[model samples]
Target: MAVALSTVAEAMLMDPALTAQIKPYEPWLLISGVFVLFILRRLTCRALRHRVDRIGYRLFGERGLLIWFWMNAPGVILHELCHACVVLLFRPFGFRITKITLFRIKPLVQERPYGMLQRGMPQALQLGEVQYVRPPGRLVSHIGDGLSAVAPLIGGIGAIIFLYWVATGYNIWEVRLQLIRPGWPWWTLLFAPYLILTITAELWPSSQDWRGARWLLTGLLLLAGIALATLWYTHVLVFNEALLQGVASVALHIDFALLALLILDLAIFIVADLLNRLL
Candidate 1:
């Protein structure tokens, strides 16, 4: 096991592209970017709250209002599927999905509440819900729950990767960092913008999801701290050097992920305006 870990560490160290892309910035910036995208999604949705609700009401009044739910169903389904997939991955034989609520019987938040006091109210929404049985085991359960909780973000990662693959014919596993230039008509006008809005809007984790995974995040941080302390204490060993390099390489990849998310935010802003005009 030690030998295998050392070999894998050595491979991570040898990879330059992954480490070089974001040389000046810290890896934590990527984590912050993740949060920024979350806020941006909320703001974008809030801005469109009135228009979206208006469209839904106009197209299908109180009688058949589920049409709006159906319109956004693709994104909702994909988001929940990501959570389900992660649960299955960790649980294997034990996972069980209890239920999936495609639409709320009523809006999660009120539509168009006026006055400064009402501003505190959440924007109108038709969020879907998924419930499932968690697997047994403390550590395994924490990891599974954490990953499942952030499943929408995981889905966003997949969306960004799929967009990259479609635009540049590049494999994400290779850690390629080439951008699809803004001049690319097909990307700028269509797939890129659509994917950005679709993925970003679903990246918010519900409060229950966060509650389920809180300890899992704490445990990860503790483990990371230990790894850093060990690396500092073993600076003389070649294996330690490889481990440090591997960590840096992983940091760069995270930076890339964050950058992609930020770019998606920009795309969503533009698309949101276009949508407001059209719908």
Candidate 2:
């Protein structure tokens, strides 16, 4: 399988035409796709929320705010759980769930917030936090921090893969093989659009998340640089081939998932607008 994937990667690298054809879609697997997903999810949340609030206010008056919070609680809980799980996995020492708050009003009262800031009056929002004992080393600490910050992304990727398997009754490797042979099941498409949107919406890392993960990124760059230098010096074709093949295979799978997410976001926007008009 590795050799076959390496051969495919090598063939694509050798063919300028193939590279050119695929180049335009590369952005969908990186930062651009993430940015678009965040924006779309935000917009969709706002739209659906408006509808929820409008109906709730009419029925429940001031309690509508609480209703809104609980309605969205499941996703928020899952997001926090992902972070906590990653921290526990890496730290191993111990961890604590610090807070799960529907409203953080202390900062509003103080006219200052420790983390994020908003200009308007106080509003209730769901947030979760976890605290864990850091490992006692520089390199290990950075890796742990990075993993904790990126747990949601890892969870999102797993969710997409799981959804694919559930839909097609085949694991990721089998699906990839089927895709290679142009024999992927059409039934998988039915569930994929929904799962892709769900995963992409939760995959984005916050500004705070990146701040905690800076050392991890630095460590990764250093390791990558070392690896490249070693490969260049040794001229190890096997290692290079294996690495390229692995990357290409993973990239192909993620690219498909992200493209589906993009399409789903568009559909959601259109549907949200239509629903708003009807409301």
lDDT of 2 by residue, 1-279 (tens): 999999999998999998898775554444354456556556775665566566556667866544544544444445556777776665454333344442342223323222221111125332445445553565666676677777776787777677766665566544243432245567777766565555455455655666667788887899999998887788763555456556666655555555545556667657655655675
In candidate 1, where is summed lDDT lowest over 10 consecutive residues? 112-121
User: RMSD per prediction, one decimal?
Assistant: 12.9, 9.7
Clashing pairs in 2: none
lDDT (0 to 1) per candidate? 0.58, 0.57
lDDT of 1 at 42: 66
Per-model TM-score versus the true fold: 0.57, 0.58
Backbone clash count, each prediction separately? 0, 0
Write down the worst ten-residue block by lDDT for model 2.
Answer: 113-122
Please report the TM-score between candidate 1 and the true structure: 0.57
